[model samples]
Target: MKQFLILISFLFVYYSTAGIEQAPPNFKVRDKQAVFVDFRRAQYNITFDVQNHRALVETKILFEQKQKGYPLFDLVNRPLSVTIHDKEVEVSLIKTPGDASKLRMIEKELPKGIHQVIIHSEIENGTRFSTNDRKPDWGNVSSGFFIRDLRDRMFLEKYLPTNYEYDQYRMEIDVKVTGTKRWHSLFTNGEKTKVSENHYRVRYPDFYTASSLYFHLVPINRFVRYYLTYPSIDGRDIPVTIYSNYRFYNYLAKKKAWKVMRELEADYGAYPHDQLIIYGTGLRGGMEHAGATETSIVSLGHELFHFYFAKGVHPANGNSGWLDEALASWRDKGYQTVDLPFYDSANLAAHNLYTRKTDKRSYEYGRSFMGYLDKQLKEIGKPGLKDFLRVFFAKRKLTTVTTEDFKSDLEEYAQMSFQADFFQYIYGGHMPPESGHKHVDHDHGGEENPHHPARTEAEMLSIL
Candidate 1:
């Protein structure tokens, strides 16, 4: 009996301690900091079973180990199974500290090299899209059925097992979806290739891995689709399409879009993508995506302009949201000649750029800061926003830009220092001095130094 107990202890020590020693030296993790891996790409095959209120999904991810250590994948919800390097492995789904979403990481140690991982899971089609009667409408305000609606909705959480919001994994993807017989139409960001009657494939060369995969699955009766070609400045035909419910609204929206596209082309060279698709939503305003945008007539111009600033040259990460927002709001000519209200001591530079909570400040302060850029450009006797955009887009299109990168570009273009302006107005969160007001003199290139007028709250309300 004593010999049996001694044998069990000896085996435990061998398997726990000596077994780990047999791993590669890089895998001998002393602490969490030693783990370093770069996620490369992810591929997804999904079967959307709306009738069953669930989806069966399989995802494969490719990653490279920068050093000898384990890599962690930000996976939300429970997964049926997780595998590393083609082998099923045990994984812990501990709640990540300081996160409210109950997100967990699938962590595994690996040797220093490239590897492929897979996750298979079944997800519930939650009641987020259900009506009071318990019928799923998918936000079909137009009386349509859409599987992946982007009406301020999050399909990523339900369908994808991914990392946290800030860790953006930019990668190419090949996606296939089946079981769409009930839906009338489906629209995705990639080029559509039909495989079977109800099965389809979409291919993306470089998808914004960190962002949500937006899909619009709508009933046929809800949308009016059309195609038209506009002449580019370089004499090439640009194919444009619009999907919406109202014919009159689509007509007017197309007109505005064409004008904006032309203006953007002239300023920023050619549009980067092969074609542009605009999806109309019952929801007010719009959101931008690569090669496409979702919008309404009220915000057609603003959202369309994002193709150049936001989608064309994406902001580097969450902390750089102001870069694109500032440019987009600046391009929004609707705000140029109005009663430009002042921010209530709110500055965009000092604000955390990641969360959606800062959107209001990002727009208000970002627009004001961009206005400051116009002032600086004019001070050097240079043409203002248009010329600056021409240069910026030429240099940074189809890429990501950081705040520091934008500042450097502005400094280079103006041929004057912007160190103080960046620090005070952007980094320090200080409102621009009164000198940046529209009332400042420009005809004689001289400053009036006049006291700026402050309207009463009632006047502000009336103007708004």
Candidate 2:
């Protein structure tokens, strides 16, 4: 027993210090005040016991502190133990700014240097196991499902120790499943490798943020998975995988996905991610993860188009979230151009500094602005908004962008001053009128969808 304990301690220490000398990727910090430390890499070893309904997670994060300050990492569940550079440290939960919940903040102040932090936690409420004859919506008899959709700041921090979306770092996850003999399959946006019968390892890119990862583990037989290789116009054979609990919709999903991919590739340059993963929920609407999506058959095209916009040129904050949704909704509406006078005030890109939720008006009001821009561009003998998007995606792939970044890029591309339009429509909450025409009131409400509940400022205020 003494030798076993020593071995475990040595292994933990070894993992904590591994690859500490390497330099982290040089990515610009979006919000420096919100995130103090620079995250280099994060590694997690998770063990899930289906029968016991337990999930044990061991995490090691390597980061660099440019200034002497206290570090903050968000985790909904408190850790059992936390060690900073092999020294045990105490942590406290404080109310996260602009969020309704709290985050775990380290109490000690550290010098400006690289540091290794280790955290151990057990997830009790995040995993749901099957009970009696009823199966959970996400889990089955021999498996458990873990999903982290970016709705109202629910990222990897819901189940793991993670930084915010402003920080991107390389991540590796080691998963082990126990109390089940059935084969389990892992679907994610990372590069996966099978280590053993029930042990799997996944490595995500160095540019992945907390919201960029899409992870799901389930029994192989629970869902029907369809795989195909799409020949891209950029001379790459992209692997596409679509899986769902219902098998009958898999064929139609694949066809729609193929058609959408072709359209997106023609608009954009190429598929930006390593692979395409789709979880067809056969529902009404969908949520877009980086390279993967949990979408309905009707919303498959819209979700897949996000890989080039939302996931490709990532938004750094809530204020910038309207760009991708507006672009996608415009594309979904057949890229219609309109010449109409705007009268309503709906500020979609003006939110608090710590806010992370996208505005609800991004669906209809933001889309109308896109159409208005398209008409303005065409009238000036320039290409439409689609052409500008193609150029924008080509230049800004795999990078974080803000509303100002989009405006500057567009101004540089079009060689015109859109400052007034952006200030009035996006930031100032008033749209500029076009010609002598009847003003349209877009402030009635956003398009109602049953699947996606409205997340307005009023709702957030209520939650707070």
Candidate 3:
């Protein structure tokens, strides 16, 4: 009997500690289970089995405001009563409903440093409503209501743990609904354990995080099936998906689309998430989510490039999200085509063309610049390029940057004014600078176009 007990105990220990090697790591503690959030009563009510930090808030918001089904994410004229750790605090609230939805509460006095906050506000139930297309016109484009409300967590600054910077935070979400379906598909971080027709729960480490907006996949549309792309750059079983309206594209040429992203991995490192995605959306552009990025299928390379640049590379040039879009577009070329000078000098010509189309969308320009930088990095030596990117992001902490910042940093590093013309070209959208132009090889430009055409995924294994 004693021997049997010992054997059982050993088995438990082995299994508990055994599976971690193949799984993603967890950095922060997350709350347990699929708990319900009930806001269908008088004032927004919140209750959770407190295992960690806790906050209780009472908000004075107009319950009769026009709700396009995304109220907490929509505009509000109501005041708030913030209660953190049982202490009532006053906070000023502001909301801007746009692509970059802004909701911030300015409070001058606090203990001054970091403090976990909780917010309780009356928000629209976000239930499905048949609109012009089940998507409201929030801006020039229209989208399913919840898509616009992605950053809604930041709407309540008085009692919620939200800010511009990324960090880990625990949340217990409870939204009351009157629908027949009690289960909703929740796409979150971590492994999928619980799955139902209505409820979906997943967990994640989330070292760096921003407020996210997501409902079940069905809220927008129905699922086709989870498809797979290359499992990894080395072709490991890195499964990526394309949630489409119809069947997943299976053309031999279509699978070739992932090659661009594979090259991107060589520089920034393999995809942070194995599941690179491009979901069908009504909007023309895409948004860079942490794991599964969403955009149109035809724009797959450009969209995936955003994940590599925005999520992988640190922001160097400050022009809102410009660094993200331009870098992605630039990276797409190498991934899409094996053409010459197109990988090198020809890329610069495209970049000059990109900048000429004033108001050509910010993200695309950022993609181009990122591509330019990658080619330049290869020319300057990998280690030097690594150092260049390091210096660029390190100097600009918590702020957007511009090529001017790089020019200044480079001038200091090279001990001369480097790429001054390039800086102006980036800012003024002028012709590519002679020195910074991707085609410029004034002195030592004779490196022989060094990209191989028949390099299979097997050969690419060396990069990872």
Candidate 4:
């Protein structure tokens, strides 16, 4: 009896430590399952047993299967059970190479037609902020700061399993959270309804190809809020919330975000989302979600711009990520001079923007080219980049964009060849500067361009 109990305890500990690994290249490939299976919706019913430091989760996935194929599911290590089309089936857990703890689901010989998959599981969250290798620290807040948001916790996928890009299938989600923890306030990227005492539900429409869904359970009693309406853009009033106790947290964030929104709106038509929530804690850098972005006030504008570029006009793959990063970083520097200091034959050819590798030269060098392009457009008596973006966002709204899409649009707008310029900078060749300056060698530009007066130290402060 003692030996059996110990064995069970060891197995439980093993599985608990094993988390989901990063998806591999092959996982991105459209298998026969992807072609035959049309994913419809996912309904998540969750109960956060906070006292126990765990969540009991049940998720139902509805899909139409066109032909016989094996569908893949990304469960966190392992699921307690999975039922497909009302039939109980055995599931095999395949260990990933890079991360042994991470897992992928493989089921054999699924039949064609409408099918439903239900997953039952429990996810442990108490260690999210600890030194646990499997859990990230995003859920942790400072002593006075408390964030119990669904983003780091109650998202259904974290408990169950799904593809990396689940939002690509045009799937809607309904999430319900029930918890006895009264210290937290709940908010999600969905329509909210209180079902019962301590029980709440949120419904989301097709969330415009959201990469992930998030909800916040902030601890503060109340935070400063600001409301602004851009009637020319959307009928909805944009509500900006600062989930921080610091003085002027709301004012500084609202001011910076509003400035960026108006600037981008003038160039790109309307801002992409309805509401904006800014968290003043637990952010190393910043992140852009469907309708919200979390960052300090210093990076408030840059993160908000991601709504239009990264979230609005998404990259098709890692190779094209430069599109969003370059544009945002370029705008971050207040759109300074067109002459980029970091351009050469070696760096250009050695590393093109189309590779999946992360080298951040794409941000600096790539952004300089955008500035250069804007300058070139101005010189040719054509509309500047702001005009170009107005058309780009209008046409490619809510769609994944590729580099080719950008090139084709620029060509039509400029009425001149642009690929030659791309070859020089983007494809790894020398783009001789029109000012008779050598392209292969130039001074590395300062982080902030001298032409644009630098932001004052006080203005850069996030909290006061």
Candidate 5:
């Protein structure tokens, strides 16, 4: 524990008591055990700094915990070779040599009380980027590594530090990385911040790491001022930040994303987040991490909505991911629903809809399902669907959520009560009866479904 505390201090040089601003409550839940981690990594031109089989490296670590003395690290899986001043220290905890970002040092024991931890790694010959890939045309949304040239590498960390959900980890990663001049700027959350000539600390205290895992029960959420957000049609103050090693592609697309975000919010719910960012990657399809949404050059808006539906509502568990995707896809021409359905991400494949399928798990399926729900909802009133969302979440506030919880929520809504017949839809596997409105026993107070598509979604505030 003593060694762990010492390492944390050196890594976080700027560690102080001054608190950074936090997000408002709306899209997020506050828990006492939750805390944020601020990380920074700097890269420099080591050719001029290395001499006599040694490299002169300097690092700055900063950690600020609301409560202090948290169990920092036990050096279980971290890769490193450590030395303090001129003397070599005994190995036991946190040893980061070259790739500090990949270091997954878990603590064997928790600290006695709340405390902060920081550590710096001054490697021997300096770290190299050739181990990772870096390709220029690989697209900004790509999640894996890409190779630009012999000396340049575009590293995308899609499969590292495996966690149930990044939000559960509750740490912010700040990287101040510099590579070849041709590879210029670096991007993660928003705009790129330069630290030095070839060295920079490009880390944000907001990114939730544990949520990046591709699985269910993945805890991911956000906090924001719902009233201040812009609708999708009008877009919001969302920014498009591109962080790359080369200035040629290193740029900020702020206005562009603001346009798209408002347009999305106009149709969906209010855009949440102190800021919306389009993280550049090297993948064909982008993943929607809470707060930050990754977008490729082609499909941007559809994926961004996942922040609201997928991460905001569904946990990317199973079919629920499709619930958001299909609903977003049902709409046409941006925010214009055109009296159809709307979901996020992309549509489900043939295999996803039928074979090997369980519940609502595809864009095609979700649109079909939501379209059916829309008809059923018309009678029970818009509040029925809203109630369904609230009820489903209420059951599993801090635990897991299943498809049955969703089905049960809707069934009890006085609309689609899950009777013995509804069991067919749940287990025996039956798609929603086409045009659920034929049996409507109630009337909704709004414009006819076709003429005013927003009547249901926008009925509450029209301008939300």
Candidate 6:
């Protein structure tokens, strides 16, 4: 009995540590900024002063140098000070390949092995507050911060020092809001502990990437919040929170969220996150932020579906982003299957290394491509794409994936080669023609995709 117990303990420890030792599929040695160091953990201490309309942040990062190379991290906001290995270091800005914006690069080269760095910075709070409107002006903030880094170059680096999406690391945040009499509420996907009024400590899982965080802070009175517990099929009673500025959406949002959760769990195996948070904007579109989403009433299902694909099985880069969007859009359109061959020519997954924007065509054209693939899969005496997605999610949840990884997995499941189809449809921009259908013309620019239009910075300042 004693020997058997010891063996079980040894196996548990081995399996737990094995995942940490293996790098994620997204970690590429060719990525210029990420090649030098391996990010392991990050801790951020943030303080918001509502009266002054300013935010102060201190970040401590733990990383290891793979070789003797300079280290760099992305941060749009300039830092007031930086320290490496407990020594003050000078930093400079340099542009990486395909990225117009520059990253903060450490001045000195570091030898191989682990290292620690600290950074302090300040940002003028973009959210504004006004007392003149009784309609609950979106611009008026009692005191808070909202962060959603969905677009290219808009990761956590926009406000604090952080690594790129290719790196997965644990994150801890200490948030304190002051200079306001109104109460504030915190919304996040991480494990949250309320230390006191207006103070919180959040810790994220180690498997999270740069894009996996969704942090929102707002005044309690500014919005209506509803809470419920979902009895998940996996036996975890998941907590659900829905909030909106409008009072009328409280009941409707809760109902719709419940329905969406049920449908997603039925299609997939289970809800991947510990909790589900929704912010019904009552607008046209929405953004999927890990387990939390700021979405419109109509787009709620689409965004929630993302928690399983886009957020749960994360995209490693902009180039591979179409898979999740296409999958969600396909599901939204009732999972239609088409026998007609698609002649469309769009390189939805062809982007440079530093490019950070998902192709806009992933919504319209990408959905059609999925339908075509589903039809093909069914015709080959195999289960439909839906079944494959369920299996894929079960296998790949909590990990980052590339388009190639997705294709390889699909091929392995179907026991067939999809190389020609992917090369023509996704990468090479040439699809077999379908009779009687006119080829649609599309602008192939790398700018923000119009399908999932997000609020402008000015609009976000007003709304957040």
Per lDDT, the best of the predicted structures is: 6
Candidate 2 worst ten-residue window by lDDT? 17-26
The best candidate in terms of TM-score: 6
Q: Give the alpha-carbon lDDT of every model.
A: 0.52, 0.70, 0.34, 0.52, 0.33, 0.71
TM-score of each: 0.71, 0.83, 0.51, 0.69, 0.44, 0.85
Q: Residue by residue across 151-270, what tens digits does model 5's lDDT show?
A: 101112221222212122223333322222322233234333555533333333333322322211000121111112334433554443333223332233344555556655554445
Ranking by TM-score: 6, 2, 1, 4, 3, 5
Clashing pairs in 2: none
**How many clashing residue pairs appear in each of the predictions shown?**
3, 0, 33, 4, 77, 1
By lDDT: ranked, best first = 6, 2, 1, 4, 3, 5
Cα error, residue 20 of model 5, in Å, equals 26
| C-alpha-based local distance difference test score of model 4 | 0.52
Q: Residue 118's C-alpha lDDT in candidate 4?
A: 84
lDDT of 6: 0.71
Stretches > 4 Å off in candidate 5: 1-157, 176-183, 190-193, 197-236, 242-260, 279-286, 291-298, 314-320, 332-361, 381-464
Candidate 3: lDDT of 226? 57
| Residue ranges of candidate 3 with Cα displaced over 4 Å | 1-81, 94-103, 106-108, 122-161, 165-179, 189-197, 211-221, 227-229, 234-236, 248-257, 266-268, 314-320, 332-423, 426-464
Model 1 alpha-carbon drift over 4 Å, by segment: 1-31, 34-37, 90-104, 123-158, 161-184, 220-222, 334-359, 429-464
Model 3 lDDT on a 0 to 1 scale: 0.34
Better of 4 and 6 by lDDT: 6
Q: For candidate 4, lDDT tens digit of each residue in 200-257?
A: 6766544333243545543325344444443435556666556656657766776776
